[model samples]
Target: MQTIMYGIPNCDTIKKAKKWLDDNNIPFLFHDYRKDGLDSNLISQLYQTLSWDELLNKRSTSYRALTDQQKESLNEKSASLLFIEFPTLIKRPLVIHQGVAIIGFNQKNYQTFFAV
Candidate 1:
């Protein structure tokens, strides 16, 4: 399968990930969830590789902006809805490589993950 990185274009981490891919000559496709909109099938695929704790960007301003009630009630189903409604709430660059989802970018991890 083709490598696909999902995140907003302006995100610093996304920028770094893209640069690393380009520098290593690793071909990939960037999916701007902010523009393209997230779908349940994609969300499910991500969940297959990682759990809610791993996928949720709790530190994100978009997530912090949620009402206390929303935060308190978060579960896989509810969180999925929130993620769909707010793409920024999900972790940056949920990279799908070889049918696995890598939640974030790290140089060493990328090297190993991509086997570069």
Candidate 2:
């Protein structure tokens, strides 16, 4: 199975997800969005499966720091632009398998979805 995990290494959720995958002997690649740039196309694709509200991290300081105009006027295009500019603005540990884009990591969700 071709799986790609995207997140910052220091994130606890990412750490736990990585550990879970490791324990299950799941082979996957890690994509550090902070190091490697996030693709606009990938973000757009993710948007198709997950809404901007789901993919975008509204809780992060990066998102919170946005001006009122940016926050209020947020659309798919604007959200995608923010994600490309600040990967940290994305929710942690997005996992991709086949054409499936998994948003946030959850123990039950991971188990059911990834079968790990």
Candidate 3:
């Protein structure tokens, strides 16, 4: 299955995920969203598959720094805008394997998804 991994290069979770993929021999294209910049269409596509809540990293420093109004008034469009402006606000290591988008990293999930 073709896979693409999206995240900031310095993210610890992303590092772990990349290492796991490497160790398991899973080849994937790594997209550094912070450096590469997020495509609006791709963000829309991910939003369609995953909830705004899922895509939004509420635990992120960026998220925490948001005004209460910004956090409380979140909807798809607004959240997308926020994510486009702050890539770190989106979760790390969003993996798309064979067109299936998986958010976050977990060894067990990777094992099951890749069947490795």
Candidate 4:
């Protein structure tokens, strides 16, 4: 299956996910949002597959740093804007495999999804 992993390079979860993929001999492309810049269309596509609440990294420092109004008023459009402006607000290691969008890393999930 064709796979693409998206995230900032320095994210620890991303590092672990990459290592796991490598160890499992999975050949996939890595898209560094920080370097490549996230397209609004791509963000919208992902949002369609996974809702804003699912894709957004609420636990991230970026999310935590948001104002009360921003947090309380977050909707699809606003959240999309935030993600575009600050890629870090999106969850790390968003893996798209065989047209499936998997947000965040979980060893068991990867094992089940990839059948590795």
For candidate 1, lDDT tens digit of each residue in 70-95?
99998999988888899989898889
lDDT of each: 0.90, 0.85, 0.88, 0.90
Model 2 weakest 10-residue run by lDDT? 42-51
Tens-digit per-residue lDDT, 1-116, candidate 4:
67999999999999999999999999999999978879789888787678988888989999999999999999999998999899999988899998888878899999998997
Model 3: CA > 4 A from native = none
lDDT of 2 by residue, 12-109 (tens): 99999999999888899998887876888878767766788788888898988899999999998888888988888888888888768887778899
Question: In model 3, which residue pairs have backbone atoms overlapping below 3 Å?
Answer: none
Q: In order, how many clashes per candidate?
A: 0, 0, 0, 0
List of clashing residue pairs for candidate 1: none
Q: Deviation in angstroms for 6 in model 3?
A: 0.7
Q: Which 10-residue window of candidate 1 scores lowest in summed lDDT?
A: 45-54
**What residue runs in model 4 are displaced by over 4 Å at the alpha carbon?**
none
lDDT of 1 at 71: 94
Least well predicted 10-residue stretch by lDDT in candidate 3 = 42-51
Native-to-model Cα distance after best TM-score fit, residue 80 in candidate 2, in Å: 1.1
After superposition, candidate 1 runs with Cα above 4 Å error: none
